[model samples]
Target chain A: MTSQTKAEQTGAAGWTRRRFIITLGAASAAAAGLTALPGGAAWSAEDAKTVEEEIKRLMGGKELADGAKIISMDLPQIAENGNTVPLEVSVESPMTEADHVTTVHIVADGNPRPGVASFHFSPLSGRAQASTRMRLAKTQNVIAIAEMSDGKAYMTKAEVKVTIGGCGG
Target chain B: MAKPKPRIRAPKKASKGEVIEIKTLISHPMESGQRKDRKTGEIIPRKIINAFTCTYNGQEVFKADFHPAISANPYMSFFVKVKESGEFEFTWVDDDGTTYSKKSKLTVN
Candidate 1:
């Protein structure tokens, strides 16, 4: 078995802004070797508008403050069954009475019931870790929202391929 | 059929400094409300395990809040860092006001 390099484990996201600057400085010392690679920034030229519209419909068309770097979503790279797929979400924030995960919402673009579920949390909740299996009618991207106690909204997503039907099968 | 009693697996005892592993599974129909029963020809209202919580030695180690997106017969595996040996109690509650509970013991070295 091969151990994953630390860089690989972090994915394209593992690099924070401060880390990027440090890496850039190191690359500058090596004669143009440190060029910044393209990042998965959440900038939308077109599709972003559509996603925003969908979000407004779901949230009463209120402007949603963007959330970055606070929420993480995990799922199987490939689901064995389209019917029942497992999903887990975690947010790196203290569940303090003053600052905790307020709510978590999971949505999918392809499912019949797109708004899969919404969980309301409070500071009494020692932590924000959710694990559950879902029914995916087909292959689609699953999205998760973590609303922190501080009124900040963070979003993360995963792509899953549903293999077999779970609800009817 | 009435819901079966929740099945919990445990050693009934554990010890200190050793991280204790716990597994929990609850028998739930986890109806998504989108499916129709073949025999009754009626819409199944959403009845799922909405959340799960674990308390060790009276302190909560983990908690999860769920949505309709979660599948049926929810099964979750997680661990708690054991500093002292005590009974770990787990409870899973459904939206229908049903509660399933199990307790395990641990001994500290």
Candidate 2:
């Protein structure tokens, strides 16, 4: 028997199998839409926190110094692919027990989430240098802040032009 | 999702007080929860390795807190000063409470 006839024969309370399937699909779709609406709103709320705010949150009102001389950030001037952009950050420090880098926080300005990664280093690290790969949502400035164990912080930023966004754009 | 495989590169032997580079990479999707399915238009939930740590002989050497901005197949390289002969333990923690670890021994001259 044809599926249409089967569905008609199986009808109960004026609800055909075809109508039930369609209603089920619609209900799921509505449920998905409902979930996505709140999720998207939450993401935007997160994105509203700019890079500066993020840095301030991380620094906890500490004074941020210009790190042009001490912190070296190596990134591409223009990223052809935002999926994987190479980044290298090194801070000039003695790596001694008395003076060393405690953490290096990375933030991107234009991404949905500004917080990227934070690298914590100890004296055993020998050097406050690290390299990693990150995703860029668009053309924006990537900032690096190095917090020293001596209650000092250094900040530096670099701009990267991206041809294509990586955050599922 | 497939199981994430952790990979590490470290020198088996090093001179005392010598600074050595350690590289680590792990296979993961790093879903940012920002993407939507093309057909279903449903949002994909985020799942990523949120933390990585390296310890030498029970001493913390290096650690990193990751976010969704980290790309797929997370890769990181850092420096460590080898003071004594000991084993290095590396751990990667996922968002789902899964932890992947690897150990390597380094002999310091």
lDDT by residue (A8-111, candidate 2, tens digit) is 54566664334223344335434432212223424323433567678777877788999989999999999999889999999999999999999999999888
Choose the strongest candidate by lDDT: 2
* lDDT scores of the candidates, listed in order: 0.61, 0.85
In lDDT terms, how accurate is model 1? 0.61
TM-score for predicted model 2 compared with the true structure: 0.84
In candidate 1, stretches whose alpha carbon ends up further than 4 angstroms from where it belongs are A1-70, A92-105, A115-130, A148-151, B9-21, B59-61, B79-83
10 residues in a row with least lDDT, candidate 2 chain A: A32-41
Residue-wise lDDT of candidate 1 within A1-169, one digit each (tens)?
A: 4565576656877555332333433333234221121231222222222334545554555344544477777788788776678776667766666877777777876654455656555453444655566776667788877776666676667788766544442
Error of 2 at A40 (Å): 3.5
- TM-scores of all models? 0.60, 0.84
DockQ score of each predicted structure, in the order shown: 0.11, 0.49
Worst 10 residues of 2 chain B by lDDT: B35-44
How closely does chain A match the true chain A in each prediction, as TM-score?
0.61, 0.73
lDDT tens per residue, model 1, B2-98? 7646776655555554444556777777776555444443345667777787787787676665545567777765545566668778888876797
